[model samples]
Target: MPNTQSRLQVRVIDIHGHRGARGLFPENTLEGYAYALSTGIRTLELDIQLTADDILVATHDFTLSTAQTRNSEGQWLTGTGPESITLTAAELKSYDIGGLKAGSPYGAKFPDQAFLDGVTIPTLEEIMVFCSDYETSSGAGSITLNIEVKSDPTRPGHTDRAEKTVDILLALIEKHAYADKVIIQSFDWAILDFVQDKASHLKRSYLTIAAHNGEHATIYKGSPWLGRTQCLSDDETIPALIKKAGGNNWSSLYKDLDEQAVSEARALGIGLYVWTVNETEDIDRMIDLGVDAIISDYPSRVQRRLMAHQMHWLGDC
Candidate 1:
């Protein structure tokens, strides 16, 4: 475990509310985002996917999950729903995603989430504007948006090409003048590579999930997810790859991180942000690891943990 002094030696650990405090509110909705901001979390982490009309919306899944979505008639989807790209923005918004269905296995995961009706999907632009509006209305601190592009290399047909997705997202970021306030990320390294090539001014987080449930990891050599530029050596660490690829940050699965990886990232000057750390023990472990940021479905839990260590998410706020 790192002492408080050693912890502060690294960098202030940013607490990014994953999908806007998914444990406390519905995931990826404006309502949830508002709750997260109220907890004093400046970094808001959400995912984006394209609609049939080419509008980018803040959503986690490429397809609708039966767990939270309700059709216009107020019925829960029996199974998986259509790809987000198949629905027009207005068509998608007709469904309600304000709350999880009762007695659902997925709903069981977020037992404490507050249920709110009539909440529809918000566009990426809408979310940004909402945050700005919130600041203006409340005179609160500024927000740092961590936007993840929902592009999967394994399922290339699941969404549009990485280039097109990057272009659309970059345009919105530029249009909103949020280029400096956002960190663009994707599991598809091709997306990050495209951002690096064209929008180098934007910060990019290389999101990597190591092998789980017998699935292949994205960091391995020759993985299509790594894009055209990655011809990596077999033993290349993920942090090293981030450095070589000119990434501003590396957002990784919290379980896969260890002290060695932390040290390597620090030595190489790469920012480390771990995702979805919810349990108190896991949160404490991440805190002790001296990571640059912790993305969690429970931002308040992380905030408490940081304060217990005589630390916090934002300084002078």
Candidate 2:
């Protein structure tokens, strides 16, 4: 960790644009990223999925989602995800993601979200090139890429073999020559281990959930992983599990953390990075928690909040 400062002065920071600023724009689309950078945010958070042609594309869900996606046949994907077994990038591009599930108060939130026809899914390589070119042109604040490898053990062989997933993803990241400006993170610790072995220099951040992101969700009634539903388990109270999985950075849920939790993570040699923090109060509370980084859907707000804090490096004189 960097030296502790009495005044908050972090020249470099980790404020990730969750799903390219999902709250402001359509989630996971290139337009969202463009908007995020416009807000003075320095980094983007993205998700990856493997196509049938072994290409890695930027996506949130394994299949299409009603929130931001439609099917290849001009219809909404309201059914089982298992049916989308063989969607190639080209094939998946036929649908209109921006058209679906509209007219509700949900769409009212972002009335300005642009809609484009025939906009296909962008491969990870494409996103990399976009970021690279943007950096070259803008030359403003340095931007970091937080690309999540959207793979899981439950599906087992749904996307690609572990080796193949790494190969395609690593190649895409290397293709744009963004090896340095990237932070590879994942829910699957197995993927993190594989990434660490492959590129030792690569920075790794692990995701925790209720039990994972140092949040209470692990003990919540909704979680299937709980030891006994309707009753919180003693295992849920253990902080070691989060420390062990967080590697060097503990990215936990926002509500489940306090100042002590932040200090505990630091004490365990695990720094802090909280995820998916969207609401205003949540953002404020997390800021007070003094995490190393906080991933939020609204990076603009987080940036503004951080700028208001005191900076020791500037000097009080």
Candidate 1 off by > 4 Å: 1-11, 158-160, 231-234
Return the top candidate by lDDT: 1
Regions of candidate 2 where Cα sits further than 4 Å from its true position: 1-13, 71-74, 81-85, 103-117, 156-160, 212-239, 242-246, 310-317
lDDT of 2 at 47: 87
Residue-wise lDDT of candidate 1 within 141-160, one digit each (tens)? 78899999888777756435
As a TM-score, model 1 comes out at: 0.93
Backbone clash total, candidate 1: 0
Candidate 1: worst-modelled 10 consecutive residues by lDDT: 1-10
Clashes by residue pair, model 1: none
Name the lDDT of candidate 1.
0.86
lDDT of 1 at 197: 93
Taken over the whole model, the C-alpha lDDT of each candidate is 0.86, 0.65
**Candidate 1 Cα RMSD (Å):** 3.1
> After best superposition, candidate 1 residue 37: deviation in angstroms?
0.7
lDDT of 2 by residue, 178-287 (tens): 78888887766567667766875777776656545444333333443321223244454324554443356655767667777667776777767788887777777877
